[model samples]
Target: MKPLLLEIGTEELPVGALPGLAQALFDGVVDGLVKRGVAIERDDAKPLYSPRRLAVLLPGVAAEQPEQRSEVLGPYVNIALDAEGQPTRALQGFAAKAGVDWTRLERTTDNKGERFVHRAVTPGAATAALLPEVLAEAIAGMPIPKPMRWGTRDSGFARPVHWLVLLHGEDVVEAALFGVRSDRMSRGHRFMHEGPVWIAAPGDYVDALRAAHVLVDPDERRERIVREVREAARAVGGVARVDDGNLEQVNCLVEWPDAVTCSFDEEFLAVPAEALVATMETNQKFFPVLDEGGRLTPHFIGVANIESKDPAEIRKGYERVIRPRFADARFFFEEDLKQGLASMNEGLRTVTYQAKLGSVADKVARVAALAESIAPKVGVEPALARRAAELSKADLQSRLVNEFPELQGIAGRHYAAAAGEPAEIAAAIDEAWMPRFAADAIAPSPLGRTLTIAERLDTLAGGFRAGLKPTGNKDPFALRRNALALARTLVEAGIDLDLDAALEAAGADVAEVREFILDRLRHYYAEQGVPPQQFEAVAATHPQSPADFDRRLKAIAEFALLPEAEALAAANKRIRNILRKAEGAIPQRVDAALFAEDAERELAEAVDAAIADTDTALAQRDYVAVLGRLARLRPQVDAFFDQVMVNADDPAIRGNRLALLQRLADRLGSVAAIEHLSS
Candidate 1:
């Protein structure tokens, strides 16, 4: 056994397309090898991904597939044989289809009492002999996320393939991929090396690429970039800092990285710090400068594909590109402040949030009203919630936000404070978008949470009313994000604000909003790392408020630990069975006097005590306490079921026992219905 090496050389591929291509190439090869009965030594196969190439090395690949036998089902014996005990045309056809002779066919009785004919034989083929065809089919079917057409070929792929190296144990495995013929030769770096590098075997794959000026390992390339940048920055008296985000992009941009220091005018700092950094990061893909005190400096660091003779030349090139971008940002900032926050707030009226829903100004009014209505429930002053809502979207009309749309909320905070708005109002303006992502921190202040929830609810309700629901990753209005934000705020604030009522207060025009929120709550729990079953259990009990769903989860968590919690659940299930049999009329109160047996009385007392404890524990949100009390009643419940007949011949006794079980069902349903629990 020897190693096999392959590399698909192409023109410079986009950084984004590299990961998917590498994964598909590696996976497709492995799947093809497995399907062909070629056992690949796990340690022998390695994949390396670079922007310009995707390579796979297979060590110690088997030369041939093991022989195997297969059984083939044929026509029924009755059909294969005529009434005169002679072979019919069906037997000949079946034998031909099975690729065997009629004499080789055997008969067996099937499950339906019908005799069937079958054939058994060994298959012949070398694994290496089958490789080219299967490998070709797999590569042809590779799922590229985004493909392109290059050269004269209409075939679309991630990149145009220039060379393909396919070596199987020092032997050339002739194959073709996307019109490119494969052999034993691969290419090196497009700029630094110019040659057809011959791969001796799979073991030589990495070393061969390294010699040709390509660092084959992605992690190693990233490490080299980080190490070189740090050294280059330290060489300069002014320290350099590479943004982690830009470092990630640069990692995918080049196989071999050479870091260079760049500097710009200190006057660029006069532009807002954010604008300067954005100009460097967004446009130039450069790291911003930082002083000893960690304040952003005027210098930046750029990672280049080639090491230039004069580093200063690269610095000049970067400065030339970034200067004009910063100048525009500075102009926008000054022009925006000229109109001031109040004028920007007034301009918001002209901006449409949704054509059918109304303008952004109308959204602001709805948010303010919703916030005011929720203020009492959230324990925030009504006036403060309204004030925060009014200022929340004022920055949407700001020139700064218009220029950098990502800074919508941040600009509002800055502009509000500049206009001498109250500190709470200014903070709320920023906090309204409190959780941009699922794990992002929620609003900490009461007033901020209220305003955030109100704004998000208004957006969600309005968009839902317009039937702009997200489906299959098509959330144009980001209604999913808005719902997630609402769920998190409700849970984090620990407020039991009824979402259905809140939706009504927020002008509920969509009947499916509750279902939408429930779906988002499941997403939210999934983000929190909760198991799907536990999330469903909680949602089954509390479908109204996201906060209640969270509380139900807490109850389930505590209940899961009680010694008899499972048995208690079983008892609750049995009680629900008895109550369900009692028909639709549920008895509100248990009649202890009507209890004809000691078991019934004991069960009634146990249920009443459990209900009281469960109610207290629920009031204090002490789910553990509720579970403990419920656990204590489990034995008594079991005893009642074992000793007493729930549906006695006497109607009064049966009704009393049924009412006792109904009480048990109510208490358990308050947490989570046992019927919904799965084993």
Candidate 2:
């Protein structure tokens, strides 16, 4: 047994696909080896990658596959035998194939009586002899988005393979791909190290590359980049803003990294910090430096692949290249400020939001109306919410937004504030797009929450009406995300709303939209660790409000932990099934005078007393207390079921019994359908 190392060198891989390409190669090779009975030494092994290579190093792998064994079946008894019960030509042929005499051949019983069989065992092949095929199979399974064919080779990959390294311990495992044969040599940093570095063994690969100025381990290189950027930012008296996404992209763009702090013209600082930060982070892959207040400063840090002797020149190059974009952003900001949001609103009339949903202007009008209608429910003024919604999409027409599509709401917020709009109004314009992605915070302000809900309401209504509902993985309208955001804002932000009423006011099909929105809670509650049956119990009651659903679900979860919960849940299930199978109409009220069993009379008396207590809790929406009170009746319920025959032969008595169960079912289900909690 020996450690194994494999590296595929290529031209720079695409930033988006580099990690995935490495992962796929690692999974394919490891799975291929394991499935063939090759024992890997470690279970926590992982793949390593950089801009120009994908590599995997296993601590140890088996020397060879397990012994190979097989069985082959031949003609059945009738076919292998003749009427004389002697060895026939077919039996001789089968024995000849097995290289044995007909009398020495083995027989096995099958569905068709007896059959001739051949069993064989062969020695396993050496791991070295199997490496080529395993490597080839792994290469074939790469998830390359756009494969390229180079030179005269008909085969294609993400890039032309420059070298292939396959080393088992100190020996070079024989392998070849894309016309390149495997060897112990690996190329180092394209600039810092001019020649190939010899890899003596799998254990020495990473250290050897590091000595040649190439950090082969991506995590090590990423942490180094972060440290260098932070140190550079400190020298400039600011802190670097290194978000995960930009950090990852920059990591993919370098083999060796050095952070250089650069500065732009002070005049450009007049533009919104978001616009400038977007220019630096999104476009240039530079980390913007921020002050203590979390506002962008004039300095930004750019990570370069080469640690140049003349880093000042690199800094100048970074600064000079960033000026034109900053100037363009400043020009757009000043121009949009002059036009103001009201005039920007006019251009929205000419732009279409969706093909089926008419123009952006139409969407704004619908949203504005929705915002106004929902404003009162959230304790916000209708006029203020209307004003905020009216201009929420105006920034979509701005040159700043056109240049940075991600700055849609952000630019509007800045524009509205500059226009001397109220503070709440300005924040609302931006807040409407809150939680721009999954795992983001919801709208912070009441007016913002109102606007967000209203906006999403109209989009969902318009989207479902236009037949834009998502099927499979196709959600071009992002309706699923919007629905989740809407439900999350209501439940998380404590915004109480009548979802059906909101859907109706938005001109939506109430039943359809409500179900679609509520379904998102399945995932929402699942993430919160609520059991599926508990969520179902609350959902069964068809709560009208998201906050109410959350409330009831919480109560159900808490109620489930009680000692009597199981028995009560089982009783509810039994009652529900009985009521479902009843033959005729059940009485609305239980007639105590018709009760034949003492247990039934006792349960009816308990229900009349508990009814008033549950009513008070139900009115107060204290679902936990209500379920607790219902749980106390578990003993009487068990006794009644155990001692009484609900399906009595007497007609009046049967009617009374069904009515009695129905009454219990209604009260028990007032908060949630506890019957679903039954196993």
Candidate 1 lDDT by residue in tens digits, 7-61: 8888787775676667677878888878877777758355687888887776667
Query: Which regions of candidate 1 are displaced past 4 Å?
Result: 43-47, 114-124, 143-146, 230-245, 289-294, 509-511, 584-586
Candidate 2: segments with Cα more than 4 A from true spot: 73-80, 87-105, 108-116
Instruction: Judge candidate 2 at residue 493 and give its lDDT.
Output: 80
Candidate 2's residue-wise lDDT over 448-523, tens digit each?
A: 9999999999999999999999999999889999999999999988777989888988989999988898788898
Which stretch of 10 consecutive residues in model 2 shows the poorest summed lDDT?
36-45
Determine the backbone clash count of candidate 2: 0
Highest lDDT: which candidate? 2
Clash-forming residue pairs, model 1:
65-127
TM-score of candidate 2 relative to the true fold: 0.95
